[model samples]
Target: MSGDVTLLLQAWRSGDAGARDRLAALVLPELRLLAGRQFRGERAGHTLQPTALVNEAWLRLSGLERIDWQDRAHFVHVAARLMRGILVDHARRRDAAKRDGGQRITLTGLDVPAPEDGLDVMALDAALARLEQLDPDKARVVELRYFGGLGIDETAEALGCSPATVKRHWQAARAWLYDALSPG
Candidate 1:
């Protein structure tokens, strides 16, 4: 199944319109699941729905023309990154309007105990940006694992690194994120 998705992605990149449609059909459910995870701990009456998130991510992905389209994991990782950007942008817009003081999302599945009030999306994005500057590899590990919802091996595959290395990065990144996000 992964191979099929990868082929569809590659074909889509090669200018096959049918391949794009097939790829969308193949990956929509997984994308929805990924989006659903991010929204799991959000407050009631949030403006975005999982389906809407998936559609937005899909739209942004469709406009991308330069990606290499390596594999299913790689494709999903890119989509996940885009979803994070969308969420952060949404949070920033809401924050500017002083709507509920911005959107807060849980770090529940990132091997860290999320604060009871959840972490603000904009804050997390800023922390991640700082981490990116400090150590890009570690930041990628966190983005792929947390935002991409990738497992250890899948993250390794996406990063073209060893599972052990992915594990190390994940541990180190989580610690850094914990410190960066903790209230002093």
Candidate 2:
């Protein structure tokens, strides 16, 4: 199944419209699951649902003219990243609308505890951008594991690294994020 998906992705990259459609059909369920996991961490009154997120990500992905997709893992990683951007953009807009009462999103079930309330999505996004600047691999580990809801093995597959490497990066990224997010 993965091999077929990979082939479809490759064909899509090469501008095969049918391959693009087939790939979307093949991966939409998994993408929905990933997006659903992400929305579970959102605030109770959040506007965007999981399906909406998936749709937005799909729309954004469809607009990309060229992508050198490596395989299923790579496609999923990109989808997760797109979903994250959509959520962050939504958060930013919501925050801008309510400056004094910005929206908050819980970062839960990623082996890192959040404050009793929740974390500001924009702040976390900014911290991740900084982390990317410092260590792109570590940041990607965080993105796949935390935001993407990928397991260590899955993240390793996406990153083309050993699970041990994923574990190390995950631990370090979590610690760094905790410190960066902690208030004085």
Candidate 3:
């Protein structure tokens, strides 16, 4: 099944419209599952539905013309990354609106424990950006495992590293993020 998805992705990369549609059909369910996992940790009353999130990510993905699709894991990783960007952008806009008397916004997930109350998405995103600068491999391990909802072996495959290495990075990254996000 993954081989088929990979082939379709490669075909899509080559600009085959039929392959794009077929690939969407093949991957939509998995994409929805990923989006659903992301939303499960979101604040109650958050406006975006899982399907909507999947659609938004799909739309953004459709616009990209340069990605070298390696396999199903790679494709899903890209989709997850796009969804993260969309959620982060939404959070920033919500924060901006709140400054003008709009409702406060909260974002959850990324497996960070609630800090006193809950995790702030914007702060996490900022800290992640800094982590990316400091140690890109560790940051990617966090992103793939936490945000992408990928398992240890899957993450190892995606990163082309040993599972032990991924586990080490995952543990270290979680600790670093926890400390960085902790109240000062």
Candidate 4:
């Protein structure tokens, strides 16, 4: 952890609410960038804009003030959590829309390269739940690397592993998730 991060964490721990706001300000730009990268290769016709996703994530993240904010690694982990929450919330809305007999809400454009042609959010969430049960570390790695749009190097740094290890875990986790989430 850098001196600035240590100082901020101390302030946050001391209950200086303003420090939490500063932390959000410092981190929001990077969060926005990561959100953009997460959607970079999406099919152009997909409806959800990257900016909207990031803004939604920002709103959700801003509500988390009780976090320990241990260091950069901790920040990435929390950001991944925030991103997952945003996606899940969006998924829930899509679910509601479908129940109301509106147009089908499709996230199939996310391009998860499972044997399956596309992934509905519900299936994806279920797969993640199974992954969490099987191997929490691998699941977190998947969330941070894929959903958080972090590179292998960044993931390695966050998870305290070698880049090669990060690659292996990513591949295995993706394959497992693909199988688990695959439509029967």
lDDT, candidates in the order shown: 0.86, 0.82, 0.78, 0.68
lDDT comparing candidate 2 with the true structure: 0.82
In TM-score terms, candidate 2 sits at 0.92
In candidate 1, list every pair of residues with a backbone clash. Answer: none
Per-residue C-alpha lDDT of model 4 across residues 27-118, encoded as one tens digit per residue: 66777787777666454554566678777776765566676666767667876777766666776776687673211223332335543223
Q: Is candidate 3 or candidate 4 better by TM-score?
A: 3
Top candidate by lDDT: 1
lDDT-superior candidate, 2 or 3: 2
Model 1 RMSD, rounded to 1 decimal? 1.6
| Stronger candidate by TM-score (1 vs 4) | 1
Ranking by TM-score: 1, 2, 3, 4
Error of 2 at 17 (Å): 0.9
The candidates, ranked best first by lDDT, are: 1, 2, 3, 4
Q: Residue-wise lDDT of candidate 3 within 56-75, one digit each (tens)?
A: 88999888889899998898
Give the Cα-based TM-score of candidate 3 against the true structure: 0.89
Q: How big is the positional error of residue 154 in model 1, measured in Å on the Cα after superposition?
A: 0.7
What range of 10 consecutive residues in model 1 has the weakest lDDT sum?
A: 108-117
Model 1, runs deviating above 4 Å: 111-115
